[model samples]
Target: KLKLSLQEKKCSIEQKDRAISDLSMEIQLKLNEMIHIKTSLSGMSSAKTIIEAQLSAALSQITGKDQHITDINKELTDALTSIVDLKAKITTGEDLRKKLHNKVLELKGNIRVFCRVRPLLADEIVKNGDSDSILHLNILSENSIELLKGTANCDTSSMSGLKSRGNGAVEFTYDRVFGPKHTQADVFEEVSQLVQSALDGYNVCVFAYGQTGSGKTYTMEGVPDSLQDAGIIPRTVTHIFTEIERLKEHGWEYQIETSFLEIYNET
Candidate 1:
């Protein structure tokens, strides 16, 4: 009886030991699962922080670009506004031009027109064998003579007094005072005075009009070869320069620009 009782006690101790071991193994498994979940959560938090930082940086760069674009747009707007205002103050050839023209006419200023003829060559006179060739002899045919006479007498009703001598010499004088003889400086002087008048708020136009081969170009432009043969253009340009220099003495300033244009016949 005593031996049997001892064996039963030993078996009871062994079962207790097995239960403790099983409890320890279950606690270890629960701790391991908690650690794994904590690790996953930590990784997710780090990834979220990195994404937020990148997003914030990208947003800042985009904002800066937008601000730059806004500044450029503002500058362009200001420039356009300035251009509009400047154009508003300027005048063109329309109602304003007509008003200016009327005002100029009211001043009763008359621009002088002068005519010059080149002297006939001595060889032509000798070839004609007429010492009187210089006299009232007409070089142009009758139609041309009539045309020239008409042009000359158009402004004034009186024809120039013409005296034809028996020796073929002719003397002619107009009723009004004649202009200074044709010189290289004549056109420049006349045009320069008109140009200077612009400072006094006057508009001026300088141009040439005449029949073909009538020295219109010669009078407007000058002969470049030599001073004796120089025409109107060079002389006037010199006059203009001198006038500008003279103007500096006064309290006047000028900015000048030149433009050239040519017209051609229709195709």
Candidate 2:
């Protein structure tokens, strides 16, 4: 009986030793598993941080690009607006110029005939008591001449030589002849006064009228012999140029044009 009891006690000790070894092996395996899980979690955390950083940087760049595009859009819009305003101003100016031109044409169309008279000689009259050698002055017509002699220093008397009249009806001195004077400026000034009236929205008409023997032709038409006595047509042209120059003194922009026409009656 004593031997049997000792054998049982030894068996109990061996079982306790086997149980301790199994417990130690299980603890080591659980520790290795925990280490692997920790390493994997760390790697995943690092990858997530890098992705988040990349996402944040990409978003910032997109925001900067969006701001640049917004600025470009604003500048383009401002440029377009400025261009539109300039076009509008140009259109208004053109319309104003057209209106002014039309007004000028209207004023010119409403004018009546302006009569210009030629200078006459005082000697053409006959006096009962005067001898043939004595010079006499006569008043011919109601029309009077515009003498520019007071304005210019030119001597008109040098043209006083008598020339053969066209019809031999009368003889006259060149100085006393009915015609335009040598003062080109004075003539232009006189005509500009009339043209300026049109610019002021007034009507005007210019004409020369007289009897057949009178100096009407000499006054209105230019003659080849007298360089100083050019007709009203040339003087009027100079007046227009002068007026254009005068108007330029102001800030107004203007343009000048000329057109000539003749009426021909076809039988």
Candidate 3:
């Protein structure tokens, strides 16, 4: 009976020992899982810090761009204001220039005369039935004319402008004279300066006096759309309008007024 009781006790002690070993293994596995969870939390915290730093940098960059835009806008507005002031100054300067220019023109000549001789057309020769015109007019100088021959005999002493050279030929003097060889541009070169006098607030008078069909129309109104043959009226209009357009950039404005009247046959 004593030997049987000892064997049963040993078996019960062995079962208790195995149960303790299983409990120890289970606790170690639970510790390892806790360590893994802690490591995951640490990694998440580091990532949050990096994200916060990147966000701060992005916000700072956005603020810098906003300031730069503000500065540029202010500079643009100031530049525009300065341009306005400059335009006003230019307008004042233009007024002063007009006064000075008028004074200079007054000193030069209040009344000036210019003459342009016309070329003989082929139609005129056919109508007259002769290559030679009846009157022999010759240009002695830029401001002088010599009549080579004339049917009408006149006393030189009676005439104020005529000077007798020889053989009934007489020379006349004027302010300025252009020969048939002169082009339309040649005549306008002198006239363009005179046109400016009128713009400077002066009473200007320009007239043409010659026999019938002697180029009065051609000189005043050149061929249409022909730059080379542009007449005095067209050129003067162009000059004034171009000056007006140029002044507009400087804040100067102009109102154009035009009048036209032709006196024909003493009426």
The best candidate in terms of TM-score: 3
Candidate 3: tens digits of C-alpha lDDT, residues 1-267: 888899888888888888888888888898898899899989989999999999999999999999999999999999999988888788788788888887776776777677677766886566555554535677878788876544433223434455556676777777789987788899998887778877666678787777668888789989999999999999999998998888678766778899988767773
Total backbone collisions for each predicted model: 7, 3, 0
Which scores better on lDDT, 1 or 3? 3
Candidate 1 vs candidate 3: the TM-score winner is 3
Of 2 and 3, which scores higher on TM-score?
3
Candidate 1's C-alpha runs over 4 A off are: 1-108, 121-181, 186-192, 262-267
RMSD of each: 14.5, 16.3, 6.6
Error of 2 at 96 (Å): 4.3
Candidate 1 lDDT tens digits, 1-267: 889999999899889889988988988898898899899889989999999999999999999989999999999999999877655544232336546655664463545444444443566456546442333224342112211233321222233454335442343332121122436554454455555455445666666655555466676665777676566556655656776676564434667676776443324
| Model 2, span 167-206: residue lDDT tens | 3223222212222232434444445656666554455666
| Candidate 3 lDDT trough over 10 residues, lowest sum | 150-159
Prediction 1 global C-alpha lDDT: 0.56
User: Which of the predicted structures, 2 or 3, would earn the higher lDDT when compared with the native?
Assistant: 3
lDDT of each: 0.56, 0.56, 0.79
For all predicted structures, in order, the TM-scores are 0.37, 0.31, 0.65
